[model samples]
Target chain A: MTEPLFDRVALIGIGLIGSSLALNIRANGLARHIAVTTRRRETLEKAEALGLGDSYHLEATEAVADADFVILCVPVGVCGAITSEIAPHLKKGAIVSDVGSVKGAVIDQMRPHLPEGVDFVPAHPLAGTEQSGPESGFLELFRNRWCILTPPEGTDPAAIEKVEAFWRGCGSNVETMTAEHHDLVLAIVSHVPHLIAYNIVGTAADLETVTQSEVVKFSASGFRDFTRIAASDPTMWRDVFLTNRDAVLEMLARFSEDLASLQRAIRWGDGDTLFDLFTRTRAIRRNVIEAGQDTAKPNFGREPGNGEAAPGESTGS
Target chain B: MTEPLFDRVALIGIGLIGSSLALNIRANGLARHIAVTTRRRETLEKAEALGLGDSYHLEATEAVADADFVILCVPVGVCGAITSEIAPHLKKGAIVSDVGSVKGAVIDQMRPHLPEGVDFVPAHPLAGTEQSGPESGFLELFRNRWCILTPPEGTDPAAIEKVEAFWRGCGSNVETMTAEHHDLVLAIVSHVPHLIAYNIVGTAADLETVTQSEVVKFSASGFRDFTRIAASDPTMWRDVFLTNRDAVLEMLARFSEDLASLQRAIRWGDGDTLFDLFTRTRAIRRNVIEAGQDTAKPNFGREPGNGEAAPGESTGS
Candidate 1:
C-alpha cells in the first residue's frame, strides 16, 4: 500500500462521525495511527472495545500530543472549549480541522484559540444516518459523498491541500467554499429541512383529534418520512441551530412564507397554483436522482420482505 | 381453485393504485374478470400491454358495463363527472366504491350521481410509492398496509362486509370510519406532510444564493427525504389538497404555529427546548418501527451498491 497520509491522527470525540472516520482511515490506510478520546469514560471504553483507534486517551491534550492531524468530532457548541484544552499539546505545524455541520460559528469558535503556525480547516460532510454512538458507524459511510471544506481567507494553501487530499483519500468528493456560503447552503439543504421535519412530527404527536397511536400505525403514507428525519441526533442538531442561527432563521422565514401561500391556495380551491408548485418540485427530485445523491428505488429502496409480502408474489403484475 | 368474490370488477383510471389493485385481484383470485379504463388512450394501451386486466377501455361506461363491482380510481376532482357518466350503465345492486385520498369530497361528489339501487363505499388505502402509471405497480403493494374504508351511514351491511373481505384478501389490514374523521386523520398524516415537502423542495429550488446543482448534489444530508414525497403524482396531490380543504387548513395552521415557536427557540438559542422536542420525536420513530409501519434500518435501508461503494467494503465496520 502507499504510505499513510498522516503519522498519527487524533479524534477528540469518538461518536458516530468520529468512529466512522477511524474505520475509514484504517480501511484505506489513510493514517498510520489513530488516537481516540471522549469526555465520558464509557464512550472511550466503547471505542476501545471496538478497536476504533491505536491509542485511547481520557484527556484531549494527551490524545493530540504527537498527532500530525487533529479533528474535533464533538458538537459545534463545544469546539471552542475543546480547542482551548488541546492547543498547548498539539504538535508543531500540525493541521487542525472539525467535522461540524455549521461552518461560520465553528471557525469563529476555534480560530482564535489555535496556537500560532497551526492550520485550521473547517468541513461538513454531507453524509450520515439518523443514528448515533460508536457502534452505528461503518467505513463506507463517506464513499461517494460530498465533504465540503470551508477554509478561511489567508490560510496556508499547503494545509488546505493536505486536508482536501485526506478527505479524498477517505473516498469523498471534496469542494472548497467560503464559510459564509457554506453556512447558507447548509441552512437550506440541511438545517431547515431538519427543523420542518421536527416540527411536523411534533405537530402530529400533539394533535387532539388524531391519536398518537393512529399516527404511528398509519405512518407509511407520508408522515413516516418526517419521523425518520426528526429522529436525528438531538445534541448535534441542537448545536447546529444554535450556531447557525441567522441562516437557519432566514431560511425558515422563507419556508413559512411559501407554506402560507400554499395554505391560501388550498383554502381557496386554487388547483392551478397547487399543481404548478407540485409540478415544479418534481423536477428537483429528478435532479437529485440524476445527480446520484439518492437512489431511484421506490421508498428509498426499502426491501420488500421487511413487512410487505415476499418478492415472489409479483407474478408478472 | 375457489370461486371469485365478484363475477366482474371494473376499475376506472388504471394508474398506480388501480393497477396495483388489479394485480392483487389477479394474484389472490379476488375477482373472475377485471375491466380497466383510463381517460388517456396511452395509459389504457399500457395497461393492456401489461395484462393488468381482462379488458381495457377508454370509456368509463364501457368498462363498468354489467360489472358487479365498480371502483373509481381517478383523481378526486374527476370522480363526480365519471360517476355521472357510468351511473346509467351500472348493473342492478352493483357496489360502487372509490379509492381517493380525500373521503368526504369523494362521497359528496359520487353519492348524488350513483343509481338508487347501487351501494357506494369510499376508501383510501394508506399505501403507495413515489411512482405512478400502470407499469409502476406490483401485487404486493398493499401487503401489510392499512386500507381505510369510509362508508356512509345506512349503507347495506352486506356491501360493507363484501368490501372489507375484498381488501383483506388483497393483503391489507382494513379499518372503517366516518368520512369526516378519515379526512382529519389523513390531513395530519398524509396531506399536510405532502404539502410541506412540496413547499420545502420549492423553496430550495428558488433560492438566489444557492445554485440548483449545489442543492441537488448535497441533497443526501436531509433534503433528499423531502424530494421523495414531493415527487408524488402532482394531479393526485393537487386534488387531495383541494378536496380536503378544512382538515388540511387546520393542520397547516397548527404546523405553522408550532414552527414559529421552534423558530423563536432557535433565535434565542434555547437549547433546552430544542433538545426536549428533538428527544420526544425520536420516541415516535421508535413507535412507528415497532408498529411495523416502517423499517428500522438506517437511511431507510438504502443499499450501498445502488450508487455508492459496493457492499463488500463494509468488512463489519
Candidate 2:
C-alpha cells in the first residue's frame, strides 16, 4: 500500500458516503487512523461494529481533535453546524473537506467557521445508491466515478493536491471547478433529474384510477427507473434542493419549458418533433456508456427471474 | 418438447421485440415454423442472417399467408395499415395480435381492418432495452416480464387464451385489462416517463453554461439512468405519445402539478415537504425490487472499471 497521506483523518458522519470513505481509506492505507462521529449513538455503534473507523466519537470536536484531515460527511444543511462545532478542535494544518452534493452552499456554510491555517476544500463524489446507512456502503463505491472539487479561489494549492490525491487513491477521477459552475452543472445533471423523478413517482402514487399496486406491478415498463432515483436519501436531497435553490429552480424551469413543448407536440400529433428529440437523447446514453459512467448491458443489467405471479393465479377477487 | 402452439407464426417486424419473440418461439417450440417480415429488405436480410425465422418475407401478406398466428410487431401507428395488408391472406380463424405499447389505440386502429373470423388481440410485453434492431434481441428478453393483453370486448375467448398461453410460453406472466385501462396505466408507467426523460436530456443538451461535454462527463449522477430510457426506440415512443395522447397529457399534468409544489418547497426552503415526498417514494422502489421488476444492486449493477484519467495528467495546458 502507498504511504499514509494523513496521520489522523476524522469523518464527521457515518452514513453511506462516510462509511464508504472510511472503508476506502482503510483498504488503501490512506490514513493511519480514522475517527468517525455522528449525532446518534446508535449510528456510532453501528459504524464501530462495521469497523468503519478505528475510533468513534459522539462529539464532532472529539473526532476532529488532533486530526490532520477532517471531512464533513453529513447532509448539506447540517454541514455548517458540524463545521462550527469541530472548527476549534482541528489541528493547525488540517485539510478540511466535505462530500456534500451542493458544493457552493457547503463552501459558504463552512468557510467562515474554519479556523485560520486550515485548508477548506469542498468536494462531491458523484456516486451513491438508493440504500443508505452505514451498512449500505461498499469499498468499491467510488471506483470509476467522478469526485468534483470546488475549491474556493486562492485556496492553498498543496491542500487541494492532497485532497485530489486522496480521491485518486480511492479510485475517483478528480475535476476542479468554481463552486457556482459546479452547482449549475449538478443542477441540470443531478438535482433536476432527481426532482422530476420524485415528482413523477409521487404523481403515479397519487393517481386514483391507477392504483399504487398496479403502478408497482407494471413498473418495469419504465417507471421503476424513476423510483430508484426517487428512493435516494431524503434528508440529503432535501438539503440539496434547499441549499442549491436558484440553480435547481433554473434547471427545473428549463425542464418545464421543454416538457411543455413536448406536451404540445403530442397534442398536435407532431411525430417529427418527438422522434427527433428521442433520437437525439439516444446519443447521450451512448456517450455516457462510452465515458464509463454507466453500463451498456440491457435493462441496467438486471437479472431475470420468474415473472410476477400470473393475474389469475394471484388475483383474490 | 412441448406441443407446438401453432403451425406458423408470422412476425410483421424484425426489431428487438419481433426478433426476441422469434427466438423465444423457436426455443420453446411455440410454433412449427416462424415467418418473419419487415417493411425494409435489410431488416429481413438481417433476421435471416441471424436465423431468427424459418421463412422470411418482404411482404406482410406473403408472410401471413396460411399462418395460424400473425403478430404485428411494428409501432402502434402502423398497426392498422399492416393489419389491413395481411387480413386477406390470413388463414381462417387465424389469431391476429400485436406487441404495441398503446393498446387502446392499437385496438381501435386494427380492429376495424381485421376481417370477420380473424381474432384480434392486442398484447404488450412490458420488456425491452435501449438498444433496437434485430441484432439487439435475445431469447431471454421476455423472461420474467409482464405481458398485458387488451382484447376488445366480446372477442373470441379461445383466441385470447391462446395469446395468453403464448406469452406464458415465452416466459412472461399474463394479465388482462380493458384497452382504456391499459392505455392509462401505460401512460403513467411508460409513456410520460419516456417523454420527461427525452425532455430533460434535451434541456441538458441545450444548456449554455453547462456544456454538453460536461453533462456527458458527469451524467453518472442520476442523469444517465434517464438517458437509457430516452434512448429507447424513437419511432415507437413517438407513436406511443401520439396515440396515447389523452392519458399521457393527463399524467403529464399531474406530474407538472406535483413538480410545481416541489419547486415551491425548494424555493421556500421547506425541507420537510421535500423530505416527506422523497421518503414516500422510497417505499415504491422497495416494492418494485421485491416484485422482481428491478435489481437491488447499487448503481444499477454497473461493473467496476478503472477511473477516468487523472485531471492533472490529462490537462495539457
lDDT (CA) for every model shown?
A: 0.87, 0.85
Per-residue lDDT tens digits of candidate 2, residues B1-317?
76899999999999988998999999999999999999998889999999999999988889999999999889889998887777788888999998988888888888887888888888999888777899988887777778999888898999999999999998888999998999899889888888898899999999998999999898878888888888888888888889999999999999998899998998888889998999999999889778766766665555544434211100000
DockQ of the candidate models in sequence: 0.52, 0.46
User: Per-residue lDDT tens digits of candidate 1, residues A6-64?
Assistant: 99999999988899999999988989999999999999999999999999999999999
The number of the candidate with the highest TM-score is 1
- Maximum-DockQ candidate: 1
Clashing pairs in 2: none
Tell me how far the alpha carbon of residue B298 in candidate 1 is from the true structure, in angstroms, after superposition: 0.6
For B1-317, candidate 1 gives per-residue lDDT tens digits of 78888999999988888999999899899999999989999999999999999988888899899999999888898999999999999999999998899999999999999888999988877878888899988777888778899999999999999999999888888999999999998999888899999999999999999999988878888888889889988998998888999999999999999999999999888999999999999999999888877777787777652354222111110
Question: Stretches of candidate 1 above 4 Å error?
Answer: A305-317, B305-317
Tens-place lDDT per residue, model 2, A1-317, is 66899999999988888998999999999999999999999999999999899999998899899999999888899988888888888889999999988988888889999899999888999888777899988887787778999999999999999999999999888999999999999999888998999899999999999999999988878888888888888888888999999999999999999999998998998999999999899988888778776666676655544434211111000
